[model samples]
Target: MSALARTAARLLLGSAMVGAGVLHLTTQRQEFRAQVPEWFPVDEDLTVLSSGVAEIALGAAFVALPGRKRLIGGLLAAFFVVIFPGNVAQYLESTDAFGLDSDRKRLVRLFFQPLLVLWALYGGGWLRRHPTG
Candidate 1:
């Protein structure tokens, strides 16, 4: 994609991360909690809150720190990848969250995780440019 498109995608992704972080700390806390893996040792609420803060910080960086877009984008992409297991747990455990109540719905949701990873990479221009490019 063009540089302009990358910028737009980055901005949109940043906005979305901000929104999701807000939800994590606010109304969607319980919904997010449902995705927490059973084996996770921390309190579900704490995990949600911490991740929310991370999302907000990363999101802000993505939007406000154009000079550091590559670094921020890399971090954001890593973040998406890191949290993927929670999504898998939700699907495997059949835990309903985000309206993904049925098996098919939950299964489909799993595919979106990779898309998020790619989106972050592409939006951040990480996919196009070399790390030192």
Candidate 2:
């Protein structure tokens, strides 16, 4: 893909991430408290706020540090790994935390989550760009 295309793809994905992060931050308390299990390690406010902050940071890094995308992407990969448990937790607790109807439905998200992580990690800049467009 051309540089313009790469930039466009990056921008679209990055902006979406930022928007998602902001959305999470804004809705964290009410949503998390209602959905997350009482047994979770972190408090509701903390959980929502921290994850939102992390996502925003990750999103910004992906956009602003494209030249250093490897390092930033690696960070995002690690972030995804760190957050996988929450995904698992959501299902294990049988909670529609992110608005999923049931554990079975949430399983679909599990598959996509890992793929998103991989996309961030394996996305271009180091080698030849993929046909992201």
Best by TM-score: 1
Report the lDDT tens digits of candidate 2 across residue range 1-133: 5667656656666676787789777855576555445677888777777777888887887888778777776777777788777777777777776578787887888888877676666653433545675
Model 1 CA lDDT for position 68 = 88
Report lDDT per candidate: 0.92, 0.71
Q: Model 2: how far is 94 from its true place, Å?
A: 0.8
Span of 10 residues, lowest total lDDT, candidate 1: 124-133
Which regions in candidate 2 have their CA more than 4 angstroms from the true location?
1-6, 32-38, 124-133
- Tens-digit lDDT track of model 1 for 5-75: 99999999999999999999999999999889999999999999999999999998999998888898999
- Candidate closest to the true structure, highest lDDT: 1
Off by over 4 Å in 1: 129-133
- Clashing residue pairs found in predicted model 1: none
